[model samples]
Target chain A: MKNRIVILGVLLALGFSAQAQKYFTRDARVQFNSDTPVEKIEAVNKSGTSVLDTQTGRMDWKVLIKNFLFEKALMQEHFNENYMESTKYPNATFKGSITNLQDVNFAKDGTYKVTAKGAMTIHGVEQEITVPGTLTVGGGAVKVKADFVVKPADYKIDIPGVVRDNIAKEIAVTIDASLKPMGK
Target chain B: MLKKIVLFLAVAGVIGAGIGYYMFNKKVPSMASEKSEVTIEAAQLYQEFEADEAAASAKYVGKIVAVSGTVLEASALEDGTPKVLLDTGSDFGVSCEFDPNTKHAKTTFTPGEKLTLKGECAGINLDVQLARCVVVQ
Candidate 1:
């Protein structure tokens, strides 16, 4: 009976591993908007990398800070040199998982509301955050769209008083990624 | 003398404001006119980043780099930005996102085609990424 149980356990592990699939994309887009009564600021980065695992509901995302493009060159310089310090901390990352994986069927084709909770690391600061988004599974692909607000102070990003009112206290962030199954 | 002094002050203030306005509204520089600070092959660049990210980032990131490699894949971003992947003999390739400011001679490429591109390195995220890229050849 013990041998049969051990055999069953091993078989179960193998089956789970075999069914687990990873989805990935290197062209995810991340956009952030900062709007105040005095001014409006927007920036975007298109080459974000992300990965998702079906079995564990784990997701990982990363984007290079210097990749974020601004319309005004001086604003971009101030952002990289003064604010983000992109050279010292070149990347921002999020490593988390879907909290309600049961709501979304990875094998089926439809849209599901999902919540992702994870640690977001920016400017060398890590903070836990929950983001609400929608996931659509269709035609051998998965699409993720999420909108969340981030406070610069929470990330230790300080804006000087000179342009304090020009920048928003809470910046709105949007993420869109279409992931495809990783093929062996 | 007071009238002349007041006129001088007004002229100086106008000049200062003009400089400030120009600086505030300056546009991002075009990559086509910028010189490449580092010219390295895709495999070597990827190897350096893989071996040591900080060292590679300090050496390459935020600088205009020229990478020559065989094209693995060419695709456009959802926002219509052209992106090309250069094979680095690894699972991930050196990725280049073309600059929208500069007009490219060609936006299409066949796999296995060799090309050199120059852009500002934005560090690695599984794959090294370059932004505001311009084709060298």
Candidate 2:
């Protein structure tokens, strides 16, 4: 009887602790730019969702590909129909953990450098990447910012030779998201 | 023969100039300028997306839609763009992001006021999000 009671108590404590460790946000902003000598293309998607567990340093992020908005309608159509093939692959997701979690003080208000290593899947292709970012904790909120470069060839996206000179070989991506407590 | 060649070159130059002007100076289309593919209520829209996300995406993704709902929340984005979220009677709702240059002068939406908007559907995440939305009524 004593062992049974101890097990129940431990399970209850684990549930509460697990709930406290999660931080999430629904409106994370993700932007990307492809700049070459001939053309400059840009898009922004603000419907990103992300969740982070402070206890385990596990993070997950998802953004819908069709949500990216371009200035020109033609570019937007081309991005969805030709480049990303949103009908086939509607979302891009990242699953990884913070490698430098020990340096981050979740209870304090400060900025810490973080390294995230994980697989980022875009256009049905997955690539393992490690990128450095910054985490800012203030006012009971957490802000994350990161910049990385991706090659279209890595994602099986072929650029036609006709527009090869207009598009860059490496596309620069930027992410900025502010996260608040979950279930608030 | 030389005169004919010069005439042909002049005609080609005129056509090239016209094409260049249209390509570089085309204006971005406004949300009100296009027809919506679907018209749905806020609750129903969210329900469809939440029920079967893949089917909902196939039906509404990359299409213009008109949604009518009550305003649950309104806020300015990081870049001062206005965003209005419609109530769906659940945790998830419809989020409408307006264009930066859209006119919202002297406009204030009290919570629970019914409003209609049109925009391009961008699939769903936590919400059925729409971009470049314009107020229809």
Candidate 3:
């Protein structure tokens, strides 16, 4: 009787895990480029965090403002202080899900076009956004790639008139991350 | 006298613009040359952040902090950026990303090895993150 109960417990645990597979990564590379006729600025943050639930299609992402590194130190300083206000609003986050979760099978190995709708909060302002991206599932890992444009004014990221020409109206952002199965 | 006054003002304006341009284009200073403002144990730093993140961020974030601990993991990103995790007696620890701008003397770290590193505190995300870290003895 004891042996039967132990076996049942093991089976139950396996079934639970197989049904609700989760993917996670702490080292997501998030890059953004702003190009204008007068100047071009780019920065990359390597410590972006993301979590995905395959069963529910729920996902969450967060990146620290202070982590973004720019080639020029002065630009970084101005971005954190004058624009992003790292001391006050330290993080940018996305909370949402893949709208068409059933379209692509997570068990399959292929590149699937997916649309994610979420609320992105930046500089302490929240905005609803829909993002289109490619999700490649293979070799027990998933690679997520997305390209999107963000308007600073929409998020209340004020750009002073003095440097208006130096910054782009729409900033191009790229997200590339490989998420591994939870618990190795 | 009017001609001389205008010429003097022009020279001063040109000098001011030159200095502004130089400062604007200046690169981030090397971490090796920077001094750590706060020196603490890795476990303590993590504990403080876990206790009160806002308080810890106000005290340590953006400051060059030196933390000493046993290395839990040493790894590199896809772009070859080195990162080290210090053990904090919990699930998470203090994470330090080696300075890409400053050449490091030793990048490879074995688990359980005691080390001290200093970098600007970039705030906590699961682990207390330190950016542009350099080995400090």
lDDT of 1 at A87: 86
Name the docking class for model 1. Answer: high
Which 10 residues in a row give candidate 3 chain A its minimum summed lDDT? A13-22
Instruction: Provide chain B's TM-score, model 3.
Output: 0.95
Candidate 1 local lDDT, B18-111, one digit each (tens): 9999999888888999999999999999999999999999999989999999999999877788899999999999999999788888888888
Give the native contact fraction of candidate 2.
Answer: 0.53
| DockQ ranking of the models | 1, 3, 2
Model 3, A1-93: lDDT tens digits are 999999999999876775448898888889999998899899999888888888878889999899998888999999999999989999999
Q: Where does model 2 sit among the CAPRI classes? A: medium
Docking quality (DockQ) for each candidate: 0.84, 0.51, 0.68
What is the model-wide C-alpha lDDT for candidate 3?
0.92
Per-residue lDDT of A116 in model 3: 95
TM-score of each: 0.93, 0.89, 0.91
Please list the residue runs of candidate 3 whose C-alpha ends up more than 4 Å from where it truly belongs after superposition.
A1-20, B1-8
Q: How well is each residue in B1-137 modelled by candidate 2, as lDDT tens digits?
A: 99999999999999999987787546457776778889999999999999999999888887899999999988766876777899999987899888653565524567788989888888887889898788886
